[model samples]
Target: ASYPYKTTQQSCKARSSKVGAIKGYGNTLRGDEEGMRQALDTYGPLAAAIHTTTDLQFYGGSSSGHGAGIIDIPSCSKQVDHAIAIVGYGTENGKDYW
Candidate 1:
């Protein structure tokens, strides 16, 4: 079960060929929070990259008694290190979260 690592473009093409249609937003949403929000509202969900930090790495769920609140890691670095799905957005206790 070994396969060569495909470049991003190759992977995208393969997925499109198999799945039919695929849309790429590219870097158009960079620094565009409002745009991200609109896209989520219109298109359902989006794939996104995010900067990771220790707090985010160990975020336990509210059901685990860790506390039911939005995660806001203020000291997060600007370097993108992880991939995430921007499924939905909302405000929790007056703070925005996605």
Candidate 2:
């Protein structure tokens, strides 16, 4: 036997109803660094998509015998392929990070 996997508008409605209504939603223009920073500063946090690099993929946290520091991939790519949240930003030792 096989089961069919499908989703309908009615099913979406039912599931959404159980979760309650969405409060608000907004977005910043693509490539607009200043706008993204402004939005983050104003709205608290924002969802962000970024290009993942080998350095980022293998980041070994603070317990890896290497203390955690800003992940600075100088040759980082520009193709966005991963989703992340921009909770906050700050400078450390004259370097900035999200």
Give per-model TM-scores: 0.65, 0.63
* Cand. 2 Cα-lDDT: 0.71
Quote the positional error of residue 26 for candidate 1 in Å: 5.1
Please list the residue runs of candidate 1 whose C-alpha ends up more than 4 Å from where it truly belongs after superposition. Answer: 1-27, 65-67
Candidate 2, RMSD to the unseen true structure: 9.7
- Top candidate when judged by TM-score against the true structure: 1
**Poorly placed runs, candidate 2 (over 4 Å):** 1-21, 63-67, 76-78
Task: Determine which window of 10 residues in candidate 2 has minimal summed lDDT.
Answer: 1-10
Model 2 compared with the native: what TM-score? 0.63
Per-residue accuracy of model 2 over 1-98 as CA lDDT, tens digit each: 14322322334323223655558989888867788888988877898888877675546545752336788877646688988889888889999777
lDDT digits (tens) for residues 3-98 of candidate 1: 533323453323224655666554444778898787778777788778877665545546653445787777745789888877888887799988
Give the range of the ten consecutive residues with the poorest summed lDDT in model 1: 7-16
| Candidate 2: Cα lDDT at 10 | 38
